[model samples]
Structures are given as C-alpha cells and as structure tokens.
Target chain A: MANFLGLIQNENMKIYRRNSAKVFAAILIGLLLLGALIVKLNAPEHPTQDTHWKQSLQQQNTQYQQALTQMKDNDSYQNYYKSQIAINQYRIDHNIAPDRQMTLWSFVENATPIMILVISIFTIIVVANSIASEFNTGTVKLLMIRPISRTEILLSKYVSSLLFSLLCLVVLFLFSWLIGGLFFGFSGGEAHLSYINGAVHETSWVLATWQNYLLDAVKLIMMVTLAGVIAALFRNGGLAIGLTIFLMMGSNTILALISQYDWVKYVLFTNMDLNQYFNGQQTRNDMSLGFSLIVLAVYYVVFLGAGWLFYTKRDIKA
Target chain B: MGINTEPQKQPAVKLEHVTKKFGSKTVIDDLSFEIYGGEVFGFLGPNGAGKTTTIRMIVGLMRMTKGNIFIQGHSVKSEFKQAMRQVGAIVENPEMYKFLTGYQNLVHYARMIPGISKERIMEVVKLVDLEDRIHEKVKKYSLGMRQRLGVAQALLHHPSVLILDEPTNGLDPQGIHDLRNYLHELSRKEGVAVVVSSHLLSEMQLMCDRIGIIKKGKLIGVETVSDFMGEGEGKVRFTVDDGQSAAQIVKQKLSLDAASIESDAIELAIEHEKIPVVVDTLVVSQVKIYGVVSVTQSLEDRFLEVTGGKSVG
Candidate 1:
C-alpha cells in the first residue's frame, strides 16, 4: 500500500515538473482567459434611442405600409393584425437590450457548462492517453516488473489521473473567473427571471453561492471520470474524448426531442446538469436532483468498473 | 541433490512447472528452476523465449496459468505481498519516471518499502556508481545511466532475490562490464540471489555461476559452468611437416587412425593432460609440429549444440 501511494506521488511529481504538461496547462489557461476577455470586451452594445419617436415612426410606418398594400390586394386583416403587433413589439424591444453586466454574466453562466465539458474531455484524453502511451512507448512492461502487483500500479495511475483532472479543472475555473471578474464586475450573482402564460407560471431561481460552485465542480469532476474511464477501456485517447462529447451532447439533444419518456429524462444531459439544482427548480418533467445523482452514480460505477476489469486483464503490450 | 540441512538456510526463489499462455500462444511451458542464496543465476535465451514472461510471473506482474512460483517459500499467487517483500526485479526495461531525477526515482521506490531507510537510497546510488549523476533528470541521462539508476532503485530495498530481464540490453560494452562486476559483487558479498536473463551469452558466462538455457518456451538445461562445458577432452589441431606421410605412419605405428588430417593441420581430440603425449608421438614419427593449438568449446557453441542450432524465438 505504501509503495502504491509512493507511485501516485511519483506520478504527481512527474505531471507537476514535466515541461510538456506545464506548457499545455499554460496554453489552455491563456486560451480560456483570452476567450473570456474577448467575449466580454466585444459584447454587442445595447442601443439607446435619442430619437425614440423617429425610430418608432419609421418601424411602424414600414409595417403599416406593407399591411395596407396586403389589405388593398388580398383584403386580409389577419396579415395586417400580425404585422402591426410584431412591428410594435420589435420597436419597443430593439432599444431595450439587456444591461451590459447582465449580458456578460448570463454569457458566463451559460458558458460554464460548455467550458466544464471541454475541460472534462481534455482531462480524460490526457490522462487516458498517458497510460495507453506507456504501452506504445514500451514503458508498461518496465512498470509491471517492479516487484509490485499490476492492480496497485493501475490504481495508482487512476488516482493520479483523477488528481490531474482536478488540477486542470481548477486552473480553467480560476482563469475564467479572473477574466470574467476583470472585464465584467462580479455584481450579477442575484440574477433571475419570471415567465407567465395563461394560468402557468415559472420563475428562474438564483443559485446559492456554495451549492452552485460545489455542485458544478462535482459534475465536472464526474464528467472527467467518465471520459477517463472511456479512454482506459478503449485505450484510444481521441476516441474517448470524441465519444464523451458525442454522448453528453447527443443525449440531451436527441433524447429531449424524442417523446417525453420519464426514464429518458433521468439519463439525458439536460437533467444531468446540476445547474438546475442551484436554480432551485426541477427539470421540465419534474425530475429530482436525487434522481439525477442516481443516474450519474450508475454511469460512473459501470464505466469505472468496466475500465478496471479490462485494464487488469489486458496484456500490457505496446 | 542433497537436502539442504542448515538450520536457517532457505532457497531464494523457486518455481515449479510454471506455465503461462496468452490466448492460444503458450509462452512459458512447464518451466521449473530455482536460485539458491548468494548465487548469480543466468537465464539465457533468444528473444521472446519466455524470459520476460517467466520474470513477470515471478514478480506478480502476470499470473501463471499453471503451477506456482515462490519467493523464500511465500507463494507469489496467494502470498504476493509477502513474496514481493524480499524480491526485486527489472522486467523488460527500467521503469522510472522520465521527468523525475535519478535520486528522486530512487527515493520514491525506497519510500514504498516499509523498512527502507534514506541512507539505503544513497548507498544504492553509490553501489551502482551513479552518485555523481543522480541529481540529473532521468530523461537527461544516457541509456546506460538510466539502467544504472534502475539498478539503484531495485536494490534500494535490499531484497534477498533480484530478478532482471535483459538488464544489459541497451547498455554499451563498458556499461555491461560495469554491471556484470557490480552484480557479481552483489551476489558474492551481499549473499543476494540474482537471476539475470540476457541474450548476451558471453557476459552471462563470465558472471553467472550457473546458466539455465531456454529454447522455444522451455528450459533445455540447467547446469553449473563446468558441468555444462562437459567432461569430454578439448580439441587440439596441428600442422605438421609431411602430414600425409605422418598420417600413414601414425595410423600404422601408434593407432592414430582416428586423427583426421585437414588441408594444413592434423586434428586430434585430446584431453588437456594428453597434449604432451600427442606432441611426443608426432616427434617420434619424424613429423615436425609446425603449429599446435587447443580449442575449447564456448558457451555459445554449447548453447547452439543444446538448442540444436535452431532459433530460440
């Protein structure tokens, strides 16, 4: 056990001191920060009308003239009514763009899921490929003959990969936060929205500070584990990363469009996102956080268990 | 074959009918061998001759399909932890973190062994003669240097048995010689049983007390250096004046009919003690001894003979 722990420590030291990992980390951080800054700075400005009457008149006149022409030719009041209402709504909402700070905060809030997905995919590829690359490099044979059991060696590797994935996510989060904070002040935490239709009403609940951040981190870490396990089982880094993206994206898009199945909601990424938990709301189908957690737990267990079995039995051939 | 009677004497390592197969391919076929305390045992075979497979099984890297391997009477399968406690091995290559320095690699492996002291790390570094370069990253070291560092790491725990598979594969001649002498000293002075597998027959012959020859996934022979060389007489070849006349005279006068005459030399297979008798016979026949040389068969020749000159792989 001590030897196994020593191996994990040694693995961590390699990641920390290796120039390639450092360079890769730096590049990821720089790219993420630059992306955040660019998005923040180049935000589309909200139009403020100095000539509100002129603007309103121009928009209304165009729609009215079109409506009058349509009514004169086909005598259709339906087209006139639709055009008049749409034109009036457009004029009012055109100059009513969201506040700059609010827009940026919303952008970040939406982008976090994608960013976590990207980092998770990258972490899985890097960690999984490192292990597989040892075989290609003929290093695994060297590792196995070290008077230690194969199980301990592989477990140490898995633990090291988890640690590395966490490190990468933390870096991504820190840089994203720094850029978001610098460009758009951090005063948008209590953001919310409300919608009402007929007798139905819905509210966008604000996220609690700790629960939001912690759950997001946990989900991201779990995503990394999923990717890592896929890579380990397949022993193809690119395939693992690509499959993770496909699975996460495909599950939400395809499953959401299909007929609403109660069980499908549990497995789909739309519900997998813990942001709903922070939003203090159930999913469209009213799936609970506990159900989502259970689904994720099942996936995590099966993936890791399969990975462990395959890795232990497969020959460490290059 | 005598039963070991010493009160505390124990075999360093033992394997019985250890067979391992990968799918349809049989790697190690009923292999059995033992290394006694304080002897350097050479496991000689060509590439893919199951040397690595056997070593992996012994080290608990790969489980055997049949039979058992024991380290100091601890079964590798059931008592792997206890078995590994007194065993060390470098199977295919030196497994070290390339980014870590040689010293750090040694320290990392040292810490894993429960009772290993920090002082032992320094001791192994010096033992492998890598103290000067220990601080440099392993990736920066040459192949030979890396091998030495690997040896240092393996020896950190001061295991009673050390198993190395082709430890000198990537080393230069000087490095090979250095490692050979170091391993020799380790076995002799430290009383550590060593099993070193290699394709380099001459180096093994020089260092090993006993050589186990494997061919086609099976151990063909296991014998001491002198025993495997055989008790037969060494060959002596000579070029003498008037070899044809001498052959006729020797065949008639001294019953030298078995002596075969080549283009330039008359060859006589004679024991070392009979060299003088052959010389005297030639002189008595008025045949001048132009040249006389004795040829002893090398381990390579012996191996070729035992393996029937077939590729072991």
Candidate 2:
C-alpha cells in the first residue's frame, strides 16, 4: 500500500538525514578502498609464476599434510587441513587451475565476514537507536498520534534498518569489486573448487559468493532484530547498542566455552554462523544446516514478536 | 462568536467515562466530556491532575482502562484509525525529528495520511507563517518556531479535532498572541474543535470559549469562560466622596458584611442582583457615589476555589 511505503520512506529519511549516518557511510567506503589498496600492494606481481596445476596442488598438499601432522590433536586444525588437502587433490586430479591470481572476486569472497561484521555493527547501532531515540527525545507520541497503527510504525522502522544494512552490504560489495578490479585485475574464472560431501566439487563462483553473502545476511538479520527488540523493550538507545554489541562481539567466545554442553547448540549465537554450513563446517558435531535454520527461524519470530508486542501494547507515556 | 452554529450536530470529540489506570494507580478516573465543533475548549488542571493523561487517551497514545473516546462518531477503541484520522494532537510537547528540516518533517507526517496534497502542505505552512524557514532543519529552529511548525503539521490533514497539550509552554508574548489568534481562527472559521490544556490561566481566559477544570483525576467543572469566572457573588466596589460613610451605609442598608474602606473606595461582596439596591441606597443616602463597578472573580481565583486551592501547574 502507498501508506506503508510512505511510512518506510519517512523512516528512511529520518535515518539518512542524520549527519552521523552520512559520516559512517563515508568511513565504511573509505575503509574498503584502503583495504583494497593494502591487498593490492601486498600481492605478488606474478603469483602463478612457473607453476602449473599439478605442481602447485602437490606443493599445497605437502604443506597441508605437514601442518596436519603437527596439529593432529587439534580437531579444528586437522579438519581444516584435511579439507584443504582434499580440495587440492581434487583440483590436481581434474587438471583444474589453483586460482593463483588474487582476483576481485576472490578478495570479495575473502572479505565477506569483514563486510558482514561492519554492516552488523552499523545495523545494530541504527536499529537500536531507531525506536529508543524516539522515546528518549519524546517523539514517539508524534508518531503514535497519527492514523497508522503502532505495528505499522515499528515495522517501518525495522524495514528501514534492514534496508540500511542491505544498502551497506551492496555498497561494500560494489566498492570492493571496483577497487579490487582496479588493483588486482579481474582475472579469475567463474568456477571455484569447494570441498563438499567429503570431496572437492566445482561450484559456480557467483553462486557460492552470493550464498556466502546471503548467509552473512542471516547474522545481520538476527542481530538487527535483537537490537530492535532491545530498543523497544529498554527504550534506551545507549543501553541497547552497548548490550547488543557486547553480545555480538562475545558470541563466538561464549559459544566456544559452552560447546561441550549439548544445549549450547540451541543457543542463537551458535546457530547464527550460517557461513559454517556453507563451508561444510559444523559449529557443533550435532548441529546441521536444517537445525540451524530452524533455530534462526524461531529466534527471528520471537524477536519480531517481542518487538511488536512491546511497541504496540506498552504505553507511550513519555 | 457562536460556540456551535449547529446545535443539533454531533460532538467533534466525545469521551465516555474514560478511565486510565497505571499499575494500581488511577491517573484518570471516569472522566467524561464532549467538545463540539467550532469551539476552543480549554483543559485546565493542576499538576498531576490527569490533563495530559486524558489527552493521550483521546489521541490514542494511551489506552483507557474503562471507557471509549469517539472522534466524530468513530470509537477510538474499536476504530482507532478512523477515529485518529479525524484528530490531530500534540501531547505534552511538540518534539519533532530535530535532524530533519521543517518541511521534511511535515512531508514525513503527511505520508501517513491519505489524500494530503503538496498544496495543502504549503497552505498549512503559510497558515503557520513558517514559509520562509520551513526548509531549515528543526535543530536550528527556536522553541516558538518549532511549536508553530508543530501546529502546521497537526493542521495539514484538516482534522475535525485539534488537541494541543501545553502548546504555549515556551513562547514569547508575540508568539503566544499569534498562536492564540491562529487557534481562535481555526476553531471559528474552520469549525475545528480545538482542545488546549495549559497552566497559563490568563492565556486560557483570553483564548478558550469554554473550559474544563480537573483536579486529582476528576472533572471538577466545565463552563463558558464568563460563567466559570462569575460562579459566585462578585465584589462591588463603590468609589465615592467618603469611603468610611459609604462602607457604613452599605453594611447597614444591604445587610452585607462590613465593606473594606480604602481611601475613597468601599468594596463589598454582594450578589449581582443586589447591585441596583446598593446603588439606590447610596443615592437615597446622598453618598455622592462617583462610580459603582462589579468585579467578577478571575479564572485563577475561581479555579483555586473549585479545585480546593490546588495551584494549576
């Protein structure tokens, strides 16, 4: 409906109008360009010099085997080396290139987590402040007295925060692509060798990259939703942002500390890293992609429900 | 001006026994009142008297625990969208998005309601006389300018009822005068039922056609401005050649309390109907009265009397 679109537009205007938002965007883009420049300067001029697919695959396999022997007691390190050896062996057997060039796509693929992290931090701030600032500044009454329902207003705010996060992701992707292409040169093929089902498989580079981005977005979605809930419940932007960032930055450590507990697998943070599933890595031995998706779905619903219920039912006294 | 031109028309806003309770504490207790079209109704109350609470309920920002509010016949409880569509309110303060320009804030609000046009926005801007600085961000605006912009935003949709809570909280004399004239014109010309709550009794006395006084979550009185101030007997001050003799004559002839003699004037508290009798007695006694003036009680005095001397905030 036009009304809902108008609401979203209004919320977006409120977000983008702030000078801090503009400064944050500029900083993000600048950081990405700087990162690209650093990567370009550090890359070797001829990375694939005097190396064929068979030679390089043999070299990588030997290195991984050496590391695997040294870290045999470490399950994570052993699994990493095993997967690397399997993929290199497959590439050699199939006569596939080792993707030696540091292409733009490769840079983007490698920087996916960094991009997700930046966007998540930015989104946590945005979403947390979205509802809380209105109450803090006593502007919630202005929005509530309008003809639209409270749910509609809160939904628009949620949508606007997600849209901002999506915008950041898109900008980061495009900017990285452009900067990386200028520096590293666009020289990679569309095929990427990935280890899946205990074997190396040739997957479409674009599909894998997009899937990685999508998985990264899952974490962003959960974080932004939780921040929104905090903003609505606490009505304090500083507290919401502080608590969300603390939870977000400490989630991995917390997950690791509780990994031995069976119930830890059900924790939202443990399931938030959908990128593990993409890389054929299980966060927990019992955790599967289906189970993670289900956990995320439940958290998504609960977060959204709590945010909406508190916003709609709680009185706007301030 | 006539309060309501059409006596048979439906009330613009009707609150039926509205009650608001906050965790075992009743903020508004069974409050009921109606504001008809083409009248400026002043909501007067002391601090913690539930004026803002009642306004919040009427605007749908706060829910009533025991009653319903109707805006132009649409019940706020069941048909909030419809009820709210006919109402525009600024509760407590006109806190807008300070990061946004004045025009942008109005545009943002306009998007929520259907059928509001660019011309209407311009019209409201001009109505509030913010045409010159409407493009500037609200952070750069003065408090008075912000209040005017708030009024402009509230009037954009041409709602049937306009509710302003403490609208004149921070304003210069000129700004207050402008706002008072603007609200009076809005109610008289556009038939917009305006409900304004304020602790400024003098301003309310000048602006509101009728007033509703509340104290301790109760509606103590509601009446026309004149009737509200003229509820009890008024003081009759007789300026005469001899104040002492006139006071003695008023006390003896009118059977009233002893008149307070000050210089050449004798003041006596007497009923409105007894003014002529006192004048006749003074003339019969050849007291040579220079002037006889009846001084009605001010709204503040009457409000204090009605609310048991609790000061209005």
Candidate 3:
C-alpha cells in the first residue's frame, strides 16, 4: 500500500512539474474570473428597484408560455419551457422570491456545465498524454523495469489522472465562488426550485449543486478513462486527445441522431448526463438516473479493463 | 570450462534455454549463459543478433517465448518482483522524463523500491559524478549527462545484477572512459555482476573480464578476455636483412607455412613457444634478423573467426 501511494506521488509529481500543465490550470482559473467579471458587469444598475421577484416571475411565465405556444413541434424546448413555467408558477403561488440577486451559489450553479466542459478537456489532454508520452519518449522502459508490477504502475497513472481532474474541478468551483462573492454579495440562501414528477420540488442550493457537480464529474471521469484506453492502445497522445474530445463535443449531436433506436439509450453518451434526470428533463423517456448509472458503470469497467489489459501485455519496444 | 575455481558460488544471473519469438519469427534462439558476481561480463554481438532482446528478457521488459531467467535465485517468470528487485537495467537508451529535474527523476524512481535513502541517492550521484548538475532539468542535460543519471538511478536500489545495453551509444571518449572505469570499480568493490553489451571491441577488451559472443541469436563463444584473444596460433613477423632467404629458411628448417613475405619482413603463423626455435634456426643459418614481432589476435579478429566472418556492429 505504501509503495502504491509512492507510485501515485511519483505520477502526480510528473504531471504537476510540467510547464504546460501549470499553464493550462492558470488559463482555466483566469477564464473563470473573466467569466465572473463579465456577468457582474452585465447585471442591472438597479436590480432591486427595476426587477422585483414577483414581477419578474410573472414576466418570465408569460414569455415561456408565448415561446411554448410557438414551439409546439420541439419537444425538448417544450419540456424546458414547461419546467421553467412550473417553477415560476410555484414561486408566485407560494410568495417565494425568484432569486433575482446573483449570489455566489447562483454563479456556481450557472457555471457548472462550463466548468465540467473545461475540466473534461483538460483532463482528457492530461490523461491521453500520460501513457502515450511515455512510449513516445522511450521512458516506458524505465517504468517497466521497476520492481513493482505493471498493474500497479498503470493503476497509479490512472488514479493520478482522476485526481488531477478532481483537483481542477475543486479549483474551478472554489475560484468561481470566490470571484462571484467578491463581485456579487454572498447573501441569500435561495433553494433550487425544480419541476419533477409533474410537481414542483425545492432542494437546498448546496445539495443540488453538489449533486450536479458529482454528475458532471462522472462525465469527466468517463472521458478520462476513454482517453487513457486510447492512449494505451495507440501510444499516441495527439490521436488519443483528438478522439476523446471529438466524442465528448459531438455527444449531443450523435445522441440526437441515434436516439430513435431503442438500443441507443445504452450508448455511453446517451447516459452521460445524469444531471438531466435530476432536472426532470430526460433526454429520452426511457433514461432514468439508475439506468444511466448502470450503463456508465459498465462502460467504466470496459474502458479501464481494456486499458489495463493492453498496458500490462504490451512489449514496450519503443 | 573450469577456469575459475572459487567453489562455484551461485551465479548472480542465469539464463536457461531462453528463447524469444515475435509472432513466429524467433529473435532469440535457445541461449543459455551464467554471469557470476564480481565480474564484468561483456555481451558482444553484431546488429540484430538478439543482444538487446536477451537483455530485455533478463530485465522482464519483454517476455521470453520459451525458457526461464533466474536473477539471484528468483525466477523472472514466476517471481518477477523478487527477481527484478535484484536486477537493474538500461536497455537501448537511457530515456528519462525531460520535464523533470535530474534530482526529481531520481527521487521519482527511488520511490518505487523500498529502503532507498537520500544518502544512497547522493552516493549514486557521486558515483556517476553528476552531483554538479543533479538539480537541473533533464531537458537541459546533454546525452552523456542523461546516461550518467540513468546509471545513478539504476544503482540506487543496489541490485545484484546490472544490465546495460549499448550504454556508450552517445558518450564522448571521456564519458565512455569514466563510465567504463566506474563500472569496473562497481564490480570489484560491490561485487555486482555487471552485464554490458556493446559493439566497441576495444572498449570491451579493456573493460570486461570475460565476454560472451553471440551470432544469429545463438551463443557462439564465452571466454576470458585473454583466452579469447589467444585461442588460435599467433603471427610472428621477422624483419631480416633478406626477407626471401628468411622465408626459405623458415619453410625448409621449421617445415612451417610462412604466411607472407613482403619487402624485408617474413610473417609466419606459429605458436608462442615455437618462436625461439625458429629464431635459433635462422641464426644458425647465418640469416641476420633485425627484429621479431609477435602479433596476438584482437577480440575483433577472434569474433570474426568464431562467427564465420560476420562483423560486430
């Protein structure tokens, strides 16, 4: 166990020492700060005077109803509008504030998807190069000749990649929160209002945000594992990163095109977005959170299994 | 076969009929050899003769198709970790993480095995004479410096067997000399069984105590440096006043084949003991001999002779 931890430390040292990794991290945080600044600057000069919660809620309901009537053919947009309308109606009926103030929690909630996208891209690049660059640089021989088993080395690398992804996620969340709090007030304990199961439900902002972050982390985990498998099989960093990013960015379009098929729900991308289920917006009527979790579990095993097999059995000729 | 009589201590590295096949094409045939402790064993072969392949198998980087390798009494196939703990290797090239500093690379590799102390790392750095630049990033290091760092990393664990394949690939003359001296010192002082593969016969002749030559994926010969060079009869070149007369007298009196006679010299293929008799016969025959030079065959010549004229790369 100590030896494995040492290996993980070694892998992490290798990752964090690289100039490119440091630069990538800095750019991610800088982009978050910039995003927060833009949102703060775009806020209304007199938020409380011009935009009352009750009045804004009523206006948003009317606008959603108008858009819903015009977009009857679009099922996804209709579902989104219906959920928004339901949430607005609930807030109006219960006399709950519509969360007009941009709090730190709100900024985090709004930026969750963007944060996931950035972290996923960064992790995919890091994980893809982790194994492939060893071969490219002929350093695999040094690693293979060590006293530890091949499985241990590969596992350490795999775990280190996820740890790096987790680090990025934490950094993004904390930095966004800090920047948002500095610009917008750290006030309000507004609950996350959602429309689920043909009714309205309210959840704590922290709880809902944590669940969203966890689900987003799952998508990044799948991408990292897929990148690792590709890197191990091909031993080319460029190809691995290219393929993983391509799959991640094209997932929505690919799912839409293939969603008509019954078996498409079993595809990795179709089940990646666990947040949809929580938001009462299932991309497909058949996809539940439990079903998506099962599909992701199977894919995670296959990706990691194939990667471990190829890595342990390879000849390390380069 | 009965050269060293040290009560036959257990060999540090032993290969039993090891064979490696890459998809039906056998790269290493049934080859067996043993390297004892406190000796520099030179692995000599031409290009593509399976020297690297054998080294890879010994270090467990590449699997052997059919056979077993034992390092310090542990089988590499079954007890890889145990076997590898007793072996250190640098195959083909000494590639390291260029992004990391030399010290960082050493520390990273040192963490893999247990009981390696900071003092031991410092000792190895001193051994390889890299203490001056150990803190610099590997990307800024020269090839020779990187090679020394590799040696230092390999020695950090203090393995019983040290395997270096083409270790002198990119070293300058000074670097190669230092490395050769260090390896010899390592073997003598620490009793580490060092196995080095190289194409430089002169360096091997000077650096190795014994050598094993392979040809076409087979072990052609294994012998001490002196024995290998002195296996066959040597050539004796006699520079005389009359080369033609010396040749005639040598042929008639000694009844030996005078290999060549050019200008004022006659060369004959004869054993070392036969030189005095030939000299006496030539003196008695009134042939004034100015000089006699005995030429012993080099390892390159013996290697060619044993491998059927195939040259070492």
Fnat, one value per model:
0.39, 0.89, 0.84
Worst 10 residues of 3 chain B by lDDT: B1-10
Cα lDDT computed for each candidate against the true fold: 0.69, 0.85, 0.86
TM-score per candidate, chains pooled: 0.79, 0.91, 0.92
**lDDT at B4 for candidate 1?**
23
Candidate 1 lDDT by residue in tens digits, A1-318: 666778888667655676768766777777767777777567667645455564655666677777766664332243334444444454455533224343334545555666666666556656666656566555566555445666676677778877776676667556666666666675554333321111112233233222444566666566666766776677676777788777766775686476355566656365567665433233443456677788777877886787777677765544
User: Once model 1 is optimally superposed onto the true structure by TM-score, how far is the C-alpha of residue A71 displaced, in angstroms?
Assistant: 31
- For candidate 2 chain B, which ten residues in a row score worst on lDDT? B1-10
* Model 3, residue pairs in steric clash: none
lDDT tens readout by residue for model 3, A1-318: 999999999999988999978787888888878888888789888776544678888888999999989987655677788888888889889877756667888888888898789888888888888888999899989888988999998899889999998888778777877887887777765778877766899888777777888888888898889999999999999999999999999988888887678899899998888777767666666668789999999999999899998899877788
Better candidate by DockQ, 1 or 2: 2
**Candidate 2 residue pairs that clash:** none
Q: Tens digits of per-residue lDDT for model 2 on B6-43? A: 44268899989998898899888888889888899999
TM-score of 3: 0.92
Q: In model 3, which runs have C-alpha deviations exceeding 4 angstroms?
A: A47-78, B1-7, B169-178, B238-253, B259-266, B276-291, B308-311
